[model samples]
Target: MPALTKILIANRGEIACRIQRTAQALGYRTVAVFSDADADALHVQMADQSVRIGPAAVQQSYLNIPAIIEAARRTGVDAIHPGYGFLSENADFARACQDAGITFIGPSADAIELMGSKRLSKLAMIDAGVPCIQGYQGAEQDDATLSREAQRIGYPLMIKASAGGGGRGMRLVHEPGDLLEQIRTARSEALNGFGSDELILEQALIEPRHVEVQLFGDQHGNLIYLGERDCSIQRRHQKVVEEAPCPVMTESLRQAMGEAALKAGRAVNYVGVGTVEFLLDARGQFYFLEMNTRLQVEHPVTELITGLDLVAWQLNIAEGQVLPLRQDQVQLNGHAMEVRLYAEDPTQVFLPQTGRIDTWQPALGVRIDHGLLEGTTVSPFYDPMLGKLIAHGATREEARRKLLRAVQDTVLLGVRSNQRLLAGLLQHPSFISGQFSTAFISQHFAEHPCLHPHVPCAEELAIAAALFYQARAQAYRQPLAGWRNNASVPLHFNLGLDEQQWSVALDAVPGGAYRIQVADRSLALQVIDCDGRWATLEIDGVRQRHAYHLHAGQLSLFTRPGSLVIEDRTQALVSGQASVSCGTLKAPMDGAIVDVLVTQGSKVSKGQLLVVLEAMKMEHPLKAGIDGVLKRLQVRVGDQVKNRQVLLEVE
Candidate 1:
């Protein structure tokens, strides 16, 4: 076997750290590659050696092929592991590694090329006898053709990018009226993301279970199964909560799926590790979804139950190790569940949140994979996934409970997370009963939404704290603006949180502590630190922590990052279950904003164009969200926004 003394992790964040742990345990050193924004990142500091890839933008750095290969050569690393996403499945990158005499810790270039494109993979699966959803893969970017296919496959069809991956490049057409536009949009996104606008049409499965099997193969031709994970709990076609030994699976079904996975693997002459995703309907019928050729973010669930370190096996296999084990040798034990802690706003359509973490840590339970430290800053240029929290237990229920308990411990003081939504799902009766489907999160949670514990009452706990900080700030004044003199500035302040707003009146109480009244409650508090970003205070015998940040001049309390609790002090301004963001022009899908039509102080009438955003290298006009004078343009040309964020606010 080729000895892998040093492995260069061509990725960042939790996955890099995760690889380091396994490589270290196996007596191998790790090399981490990072972007400019990651200079202080946890993964960079943890690696044995590090290399700076590029500026903060992924195009100039992490996704840059030449940069990755050069780093490997400079570091004298033997192999490169494209953890997941980014360049993980790029066929050209794989071939580049091979040409450079560097082992790519993944499948052969041909496998990625064939399977990377949904059209070819589906053709291969059809020939190999794997069941598939009804749809057409061969076609040009013609709307008429898509409309006809949508009619044949029937309504409720899914438009997917043949060359697209991630949750991007795909959309569902529930009715005939929206089929053509959705297809056009999906194709554009697919082109923008994967550089190929190839589009495919498939029948959308109702009540589908996003189950996938973990498959491994050696150059010697031995293949094995690591059971399956029920990742049915998903948002935007991406998994949120995953559990092992699916609560409704049987041994017979396991054998059938395992064999099918091997067939697909062998078809591509697969190497290293890969995941074959499938969509299983409520009727127990299953169809091929796609093959993820690189290590998956959710690999931990498979490892937890199968008692194997997948990353280790990838390194061994890439180094030309022979098949030391067979399918029968693999075993599934216990139960496992994983929750993704993202720096996102769940209550507001999962908008990517960027800011420094004022307070919080992902809870530990059996295992958790994260890449940020206490003071880490989440950047908008990368994926918002901060870390993953996983738990192992004897039963699924036990694991579910453990995962919930772990989420409650996140004290993320800055930014917002979807933790509360995750907790609600964990506690929901359907979730506990294993009755959840891909539609569960959007259909149920989005409507009712999960509510976290009411903010600590304005009693002696929080109010006294805010007051103390205000007092402390006034006291530490360089000129000492004594309380009496600073009275004109309004010592009374209002802090807005999500769901509830606080109006606080500050009063000095002797010593360093101060007294304040909140919503009819009064108390004394000793403030620890007070800044424009956060307010930390010791209250009511327990240390209570809270964060305050400005969003469009409106204050929001970012209390929990691990949980998706974003308390908006502007809650009163926001009524109904919906959020009232400044009028925004959303990118129909993932695209680059180019040629902002209006600058600061430009006014346009209704239906007037304001910006030109480009996707798939094609220009798209961003119309005004409202008929008002445009002011404060936040994004410039070439800026990237995910899903929704105000592009140009009109007043």
Candidate 2:
């Protein structure tokens, strides 16, 4: 061991907490670096020592190398573990850490620099005799050159950022007409997400399986592959779900891919935990995808089957220790799967949502790596990935079933999430049979019924919400303020959910009962039991129970379908407009306007990109709904907008 004593985790959220867990378990003192937004975060509380680096924005905080180095120096930390994302793959950060006499808990700066660029990595892999996809990875990055290369590489091609992972700076161009625009968008995203705008074009594999091999090496020139993971299921070019021991992989194929990954690692004298991703086709052929120089988000699955702690290995390897397990001894057992839980609305094209989580409850019988707590404010300064939910089983089906149940049991109120979407994916038939590809989601759930079905049981939800509200009111109100003796009068409520409206009248009956009438339907309800946050009720003679939380005039009901947020507009009905005209386009969520694509009086067609709003580090384009001339643009570039705030009017 290289005299390692103290270590600093230079990241935030669950990742920082994850590294801290391993370090603390191994009898090492851990330090946490946080931004202004994460000052009171879970990771900060879990660390032995905490340091505030900078502001909320990532560029000024997590990616601020100088600030992180200074914090490490002040804290007297012996080493720094980047813990994926931020500056994990940054060679300059590693070099700076080395110069500061602080050990960086990863590969050398030269290895990071070599693998950080896709073009350079592809060249290295090709030189090492690894199978690479046929494409243009040249230095000429002009529009004309890229367009010619796109045509030469054929219609369906992928434009990928040379620097960074996580599908941030990636796009697929299907035809010639969309190539230029996609190139521009990809370049813009690349420049913003990574510090580099250089791109590489490759032949798009048609729905191939994304398999990756885990690699571990030590300073003694020893390396071993820890089997493989199938990460084919994706959305927006990023992995959504992952599993180990890819179903179709035979022993021969696994050995082949494993050896190829080992070759790639040996090419750079790699040391530490890394992953070499490959795009495997239906014909059992695999092409080299870029290598990740840091620990992966889905490393838990590999650990579960191998029965080894990858983080501990990384720490020991960083300390110049020999490989703990040899290639012949390392073995895989059983199966493992992991699902990413993101704070995004899959129905809204995976738009990132940010708000205070009034109620947060993780699932049971699963391993959850999260940094969430009740009342935690999920800000828009970083990634929308809340955490990961992992499950292990003797077979894939058992693991899938366990994960599915766990997803259903998870309770998160306030912000919209992909919880329902994840459940849908796990239960999908294609996913169950192990025949899924990268296009699984788009093919099956392009327009699923669960997305937003006709206002989401508006009448039942309205009645439940009103009753819940009345229960809270009774806790502090006059005994008969909302009750009637003769059952002649009922308490009335008008609510709005998105654009849908409801009018509910609830009559108080004996035994704390109620008769509810919403629109043309009438039903009976009884508050059998209530404990502030939960209510067991009899609706139309059918018994049902629900958990609820109310905040800021909004009631969130955790129902079978998921958390249904309803705005109690009973008071607003008397003063607010009955309905606003649909001429203006409003912001769907809180975000900053990055680009105003259309100006006043500009004639725009339906589905034309009119504005671009960025939230949680992802760009979302707000398009025009109807063909009309832009009459007024309310917001300019860089303006922070609230949910439902009108951005522009088309009339």
Candidate 3:
């Protein structure tokens, strides 16, 4: 495009801010597009200008091509950069950009179309002599064809959406009995998430390492691989942890994978930045996965090691600039690792969480890429990923340790997250030794203590109680706090946490200390100093500092294990209302009811799927908690419901 001077980021969240950082540094005025839900998002604030695209829904906002093109036109931008996800890989969106006379800082539409579909991409890779898993990628996608293919492919096959990525529309079936139902579920997820219901079957590669090669190409046919990243640490097919220069990679294997990736790129005449993923087995054999036609979320690790700005390269290539470095000139440096910080509750099957961010204090030693503020609300309208924390060191162990410390030190309260899980993973012996695969989490940590719901220990409870008492005393200016007519008398308090209640008694002692009793445990606690948000406490002769945020009668405290939210209900009146019964199924979070499998009054066995709720772009099957009749059905397909809203009741 005529020496592009202005660019519009056709995306949101951290990726948009990431693009803006590079584009603005390169002297290009940037434009940001936002939906109504993201009006106050950090990305919009960072851009030189912004335009409202549509509503909160992805179909009406980020995925709306015409609106984005119109945004570019109105901003008078010369180029548009589609960050990963949303319309990044949509061929029609690329074509729309080209037709609008705007430079699309990515590969051609034809290339995207070819690589976007798992079936077409696998077929193309096989033709290009790249090793591929034997699967059914035929054009015929009927139930019979899929069933026959499943039998031929044998048991333990994967049913994947042809146009899916990030784990959506994918399921692993272990036997013939579950094939049809899985196919139906996968198809539904695919159609909802990708606008396509095409299905593909692949032989499951048990415990394979999911590695990918980053490829950068120019208009002059100069393409080079920026090393590879090991993304085997995944959950539900979505990558959680990624590190550069695959942990088990040798020079020969790296070269082989890099060459295969280049071949795949060349077959489609690829340009700009892209990634070719592969499944590397234990026997040193690798098979082609799919190619992502945009910058990846894990690109920061590659950048940290190579000392290169991939976004700048994309902009330069789009402006007809030649590759900055040839394949021979590229160099890979030290080790780097990254962990995605997701707004999810790991103890609750990693259910996505949404709430206002009361505190967001990122660690200093690591590089944090996020779009968060103190008051930012983590809505359920988008992905649960809050941001990423990346660390670089001269050795793999150093990187791992640094990342682990960063994850522990970084404070993010208010909403539930997987911070503790990340810390545990980093400290695991298998992960520390780089002896893990995609099944690592399920195999090693399935029953790990960190995954279980956290109950406040004596120390944690004492800290919470002391902090709460101090805050309340200071707020009320109670000079006679903990004072009683009899010096031996103790102050009584009640606290609630995780739907459980505890009665605590605190006795004032000399030297500003207190003896706190929680259940059968007693703690000698003393609040050394407090500045409202952070407090240093000494419990049982051990001194420690914690970050805390108290709001709306709830105190969110960051302990050594993770974040704990406690409420002081000492003065509140007890309600006689009964709690929700086990037979009542409530919406776990805000979501739309996608399927109602059981009608009212229908008999259902325990563990039967009753409803499927689509939230955070994934389908969560709500199963029967007990065997009973469906006495009441309060929701149906297409009905939007809020968190804790009762969906049905089985009596």
TM-score of each: 0.80, 0.86, 0.88
Model 3 clashing residue pairs (backbone): none
In candidate 2, position 2 carries an lDDT of 56
Candidate 2 Cα deviation (angstroms), residue 56? 0.8
Ranking by lDDT: 3, 2, 1
Tell me how far the alpha carbon of residue 400 in candidate 2 is from the true structure, in angstroms, after superposition.
Answer: 0.8
Query: In order, what is each prediction's RMSD in angstroms?
Result: 8.6, 7.5, 7.6
**Per-residue lDDT of 198 in model 1:** 87
Model 1 segments more than 4 A misplaced? 139-141, 449-456, 459-493, 498-501, 505-517, 520-651
In the range 1-651, model 1's lDDT, one tens digit per residue, is 578898899999999889888988999888999999999988889889999989999999999999989999999988888899899998899999999999888999999999988998999999998888899988565888777777889978888889876678899889898876777788778878878888889998987888999888999888887899899998888788988988889898888888889889988888888899999888888899999898889999888998888998888888888766777777788999998888777656677888877555556655888887867789889999988889999899898888888887755655677777778788899999998788987778756544333454564235433533454456566566344665534256555444344677666544546566676766666667766555667665566665554333343454443422232232235322122234555555577877866777777776677777677777767666356776567888888976555666666
TM-score of 1: 0.80
Superposed Cα deviation of residue 323, candidate 1 (Å): 3.6
Error of 2 at 620 (Å): 30
* Better candidate number, 2 or 3, judged by lDDT: 3
1-651 per-residue lDDT for model 2 (tens digits): 557889999988988888899999999999999999998899999999999999999889999999999999999999999999889999999999999999999999999999999999999999999889999888999999998888889968999999857787788888899988988898899999787899999999998999999999899899899999999999877889999989899999999999999999999999999999999999999999989999999999998999998989988888888897889998889889999989887766676889898788787898899988777799998899999999999999989998888887788888888888888899888899999888988898888754643365644564565555565557565774554555586777777776777777777656777677777777777778877577778777888777778666777877653677777777763521111234678887799999987789989887788888887798887776678889898999999999888888887
Give the CA lDDT, 0 to 100, for residue 380 in model 3. 89
